[model samples]
Target: MKILACYSIKGGVGKTATAVNLAYWAARSNYRTLLLDLDSQGASSFYFRIKAPAKKNLGKRFLQAYGQLASQIKESDFPHLDVIPAHLSFRNFDILLEDLGKRKNRLRQALKGLKKEYDLIILDCPPTISRLAENIFNAADIVLVPVIPTTLSERTFEQLLQFFKQQDLSRSKLVPFFTMADARKQLHRETAIAMRKRYKNFLQHAIPQSTDVEKMGKYRTPIDLFARNTQANRAYYALWRELEPQLKKA
Candidate 1:
C-alpha cells in the first residue's frame, strides 16, 4: 500500500481540503482508499459528516496494536473509501510519541497490518512539528503540502525544508502545490511563477480560489460531486492525473 500524507507546519493552508479531494479522486478510480484524520480538531471528520470516534484515544489505541486502529475505521459515503475519524485524545500525540522512545517506525510499523486491505492510505495530519510529525515523516512515502502563493507560505515551506534537512529526510518526496490562488492578483501570479522557477519539484496544478470549494462546508462532501464541471474540480483531477504514475511506483 502507498501511504500519502497531507502535512504542513502551518495550518489554514488548504491541507485538509487537498487531502479530502485527492482521496475522493483515488477512491473514484476504484482504489481501496483510507483517509485517516489525525488532527485533534477533527476538521476532516467534520467535512465528511462523520462523528469523532468514541474511543477518543487514537494514540493509546495506535500503541496497543493494529486491531484497535482497524476497529476504529468507518465507511465513507463515497465508494471504495474508508475513514478513521479523529479523536480528541489525539491531542496527546506529542506526549505519546515522546514516551515511545526509540521506536523510529512506530506509525509505519502499526500500519503494516493494513497493507492487505488498502491500495492507498491518505493521512490528514495535524499541523505541528513534534515527535508525532517525525513518525509521520518516517511513515509516508510522499508528503503533500498545500502552499499558498504568498510570502508567509514560502517562509513556512522553507522552514519545513530546513527541518527536513536537519532530520536527514529525503526532500524529493515532498510535493508542494499552490492553493487558493487567484490569477487576477499580480502578487499571486508572480509568486507562482517564482516558485515554479525556484523549485523544480513543484506541482504544475494549482487550485484557484473557488466558490465551490468554500461550499464544501455546507455539503459536507467533495466538491467534485457537486461541481464536477467547474475549473476548481478540473484542477483537482489534473493533479491526480499527474501524481498517478508516482503513486503507482510507490
Candidate 2:
C-alpha cells in the first residue's frame, strides 16, 4: 500500500481536512482507501460521522501491539473507503511507543498486514514531533504538510525539515501545500510567491480560506462531496492531481 501522512508541526492548518478530502478522492478513483485518524481529538473520524474507538478495547498495551489496529477499522459511508477511529487513549502514544521494542518502526510494522487490503493509507497525524510521529515519518511514502502562508507557519515547516534532517529521515518525502490562503491579503500572496521560490518542492495549488471548508464540520463530509464545484474543491482536486503521479504508481 502507498502510505501518505498529513502532518504538520503546528495545528489548525487544515491538516485533517486535507487528509479527509484526499482520501475521498482516492476512494472515488476506485482505490481502496483508508483514513487513519491518529489525532486523539478524533476530528477526522467526526467529519465522517464516526465515533471514537471504544475505550474498552484501547490502552497503551493494545495500541503498542503490532497488527491490533486492523480490528478497529470501520467502514465509511462511501464504498472502498474505511477508517480506523481515533481514541482519547491515543494521547498516550508517545509513552506507548516508548516502551516497545524497535520503537521507531512499530507503526510501520503494524501496517504491513494492510498492504494487500488498501491502496492508500492517509494518516491524519497529531501535531507534534514525538516518538509516534517518528513512526509515521518512517512509514509514510510522502509526508504532506499543510502550511498557512504566515511567518509562524513557515517557521514550523522549517522545524519539520530540521527534525527530518536531524533524525536522518528522508527529506525528499516532505511535500508542503498552502492552506487558508486569501488572495486579497497581500501577506498571503507574497508569502506564497516567496516560499515556493525558496522551496522547489512546495505544491503549486493553494486552498482559499473559505467557510465552505469549515462547513465540513457541520456537514460531516469531505469538501469533495459537500462543497462540489467550488474553488476549494477545485484546489483540492488540483492538489490530488499533483500527487497523482506518485499514487498512480501504487
Candidate 3:
C-alpha cells in the first residue's frame, strides 16, 4: 500500500484537515483507505467521530504488534474508510520509540502486513521533530507537508528540509502544498509565488482559508460531507486529483 503522511513542523497549519479530507476523497474514489491518527490531541479521530483507542490497547508494546494494531482499526461512517484512532498516550511516543533503540523503520515494519488490506494509508502526524517523527519519515512513501503562506511557516519548512538533508533522508519524498491561503493578503500571495518558484515540487492547488473548513469541528465530518460546494472542499478534491498520479508513480 502507498503511505502518505500529512505532517508539518509547525502546528495549526491544517495538517489534520488535509489528512481527513484526503482520506475521504481516497475512499470515495474506491481506494481502501486507512487514516491513522498519530497526534495525541486526536483531532482527526474527533473529525471522524471515532473515540480514541483505550490506553491499555495502544501503549508502546501494543503499538507495533500486528494483532493489537489490527484489532484497533475502526470503520468510519464512509464506506471503504477506516481509522486507527490516537490515544493520549501517543504524546509519549518519542520516549517510547527512543527506548526501542535505533530502529527508525519500526513503524514501517509494523505496517508491512497491512499492505494486503489497504490501498492507501494516510498518517495524521503531530507537529514535531522527534524519534516518532524519524519513524514516520522512514515509514511514509510521500510526506505531505502543509505549509502556511507566511514567513515563519516558510522558515519551519526550511528547517524540516535541513533536517532531512542532515539525516541523509530522501528530500524527494516531501511534497508541500499551501494551506490557509488568503489571496487578498499581499504577503500570502507573494510567499506563495516565491515558495512555488523555489520548491518545484509544491502542489499546484492551494487550500483557501474558509469558515467551512473551520466548521469541521462542529460538523464532525469532512468538508465534502457538509460543504462540498465550497472552495475549501473543491480545493482538497483538486489537490487529491493532483496527488493521485504522483502516488501511482511512487
Give me the candidate number with maximum TM-score: 3
**Model 2 stretches astray by more than 4 angstroms:** 57-67, 248-250
Tens digits of lDDT, candidate 3, 116-150:
99999999999999888989999999999999999
Return the TM-score for each candidate structure.
0.97, 0.95, 0.98
Q: Rank the models by TM-score, top first.
A: 3, 1, 2
Q: Give every collision pair in model 1.
A: none
Cα RMSD, each candidate: 1.1, 1.5, 0.9
Give the alpha carbon lDDT tens digit for every residue of 66-153 in model 1: 9988988889999999998888999898888778776768889888899999999999999998888888989999898889999899
Ranking by lDDT: 3, 1, 2
Worst 10 residues of 1 by lDDT: 55-64
- The CA lDDT of each predicted structure is 0.88, 0.87, 0.93
- Model 2 scores what on Cα lDDT? 0.87
TM-score of 2: 0.95
Q: After superposition, how far is residue 195 of candidate 3 from its true place, in Å?
A: 0.8
CA lDDT, candidate 3, residue 81:
100
